[model samples]
Target: MRRKLTLKDIARELGVSISTVSKSLKNSEEIGRDTKEKVQAFAKLYNYKPNNIAVSLKNKHTKNIGVIIPDIVHYFFTTVFRGIEKYANSLGYNVIICVSDESFDKEVINTELLANGSIDGFIMALSGETQLKNDYRHLTEVTEQGIPLVLFDRVTDEIKCDKVLLNDTEIAFEAVSKMIKAGRKKIALLTTENFFNVSINRELGYRKALEEHGLAVNENLILRLPFNEQIDGIYPFVSNNEIDAVLAVNEIFAIHAMGILQSKGMKVPEDISFIGFTNGLLSKYASPPLTSVAQHGDRMGELAAKMLIERIEMNFVEGKEEDFRTEIIKGTLIERESTVN
Candidate 1:
């Protein structure tokens, strides 16, 4: 069986730029007749069908950007959206948003819905189910047809596009190291499943901090939980593990763990210390307040919007392909009452 070809595949095989292939496929007069014939012939042989939505959106400047997020209620995602809206609106671009609800089908449907000439480009974070499935054909299709895309937070390497991200591993390392410095041992890590890129990086940082500090990484102390579900297993995990400090990948997990441990008669900062990622309201309002790693989601969103808009407004240089880039935002540790001073 022959694999379906994308514009990128056809361009690579024909030794031409993607722009040239795209124009050739459309039979634009700018491409030489011979080159056009060759590109079309190759595309025909491979049964390449251009995405109709992308074709309609091409060269039509809608001056609107589509933003898709995994969860609408998530503090980090909301902050990111605020930044994107502020920057994009300043530049005369309207922002349209859709929530994927962490479902792969919902994400794909949202992409399709937004791509139907409703917007000029897209800014998105991969949904948990999309990342778990590892299927990016929908995203690849949009890019293959000359649409600009910028991924933020939960991004993947499979898609070659502009991206904005936090330094998850480094920040997690800093958070764990701070706990160790405060004379805390038997540190436990609360994280999501390994499929999520950010979780995997955070776990790496957690392990690195422990190993570098002459402490062994204990698998039994690492608790894995579902990303978008009701909190469970926290009590049992806390009961089973003799941990002096805890580092959760997100604020919800950290706050929930703190509540459970406190109810079990463990005192915050005295009996146990806690740190989590995303310095959101929940962290700030928790009974003892929580120390957290601030991801700076607003700044990330602004950068992502800038990258996507720049790509959307860039003039095509005939036969040249644009180089994609990944921008990393540095995270800061917000010290609060949950940790020992």
Candidate 2:
């Protein structure tokens, strides 16, 4: 591994004071133009990246944001993360990423750990299991200690913080309405997460759409999907359910639902229609091309990061303000053969 470059190395090489090198690199106007130019030239030549931790300790700004995600392996979260990182870099900031893998304790611990003097703010997406308890006291504690936060994806309205969320229920309502208009009466909802606010909102939308069209909302048609689902049983579950249409809370779940429905001697469009969430890549090449709810994961992350940074910059330069805000993005429903009748 290459050794990390430091200020001392730059100072020794350039025969300048350590303060001169630091001020020039940090773009202090006090340094002479010719001297700043030379320092910058050397920095670029050596690919010297300054230590943000040390700078933050001295100047009270890390130029770094901490990101806490439930699962890094999830396509949606990763896509959002990419957007956050892209925008953060454009604004001259670095990212400190941590994964909690749906554990509440891990989420709390990561939040506390990253809220140290190392970062100016935090952008966090809560884990699935976090719905059971609202021990958001730790998050509040971070905010109280003066670290700005803007939440992403799995946000809660009760927390009194800024958030980024899909207009999930509206999209669900749209999907259900479209399927109904296409003449599919019995719509089944297949979801892996049954407890989160997103899932609950989706179900409410499904019911609202059905009610608007005078279609009966049968509880039996709605299956409570458990986390530990079996791969092979997917086929039998769809076959035995006898559902005419399916709406999924996630894209991967919807894609597999289509496969299972097709395997059990059931024909899509003619017999079943599907609409899933996230608009992931695999949904594009599914056998019949799955219809999906396109959650703009990247844009969501970027906006959340932008908001967090704005808050941090404001708080650091001026002072903390009470007028925090929220952002809710609309989800688009993309049509495909799987959901067409």
Off by over 4 Å in 2: 1-50, 228-236
Q: Show model 1 residue runs off by greater than 4 Å.
A: 1-59, 316-320
| lDDT digits (tens) for residues 242-264 of candidate 1 | 99999999998999999999998
The lDDT, on a scale of 0 to 1, for candidate 1 is 0.91
Instruction: Give the Cα lDDT of each candidate.
Output: 0.91, 0.84
Q: What is the TM-score of each candidate against the true structure?
A: 0.82, 0.88
On lDDT, the leading prediction is 1
List the pairs of residues colliding in candidate 2. Answer: none
lDDT of 2 at 89: 96
Each model's RMSD to truth, in Å?
Answer: 13.2, 2.9
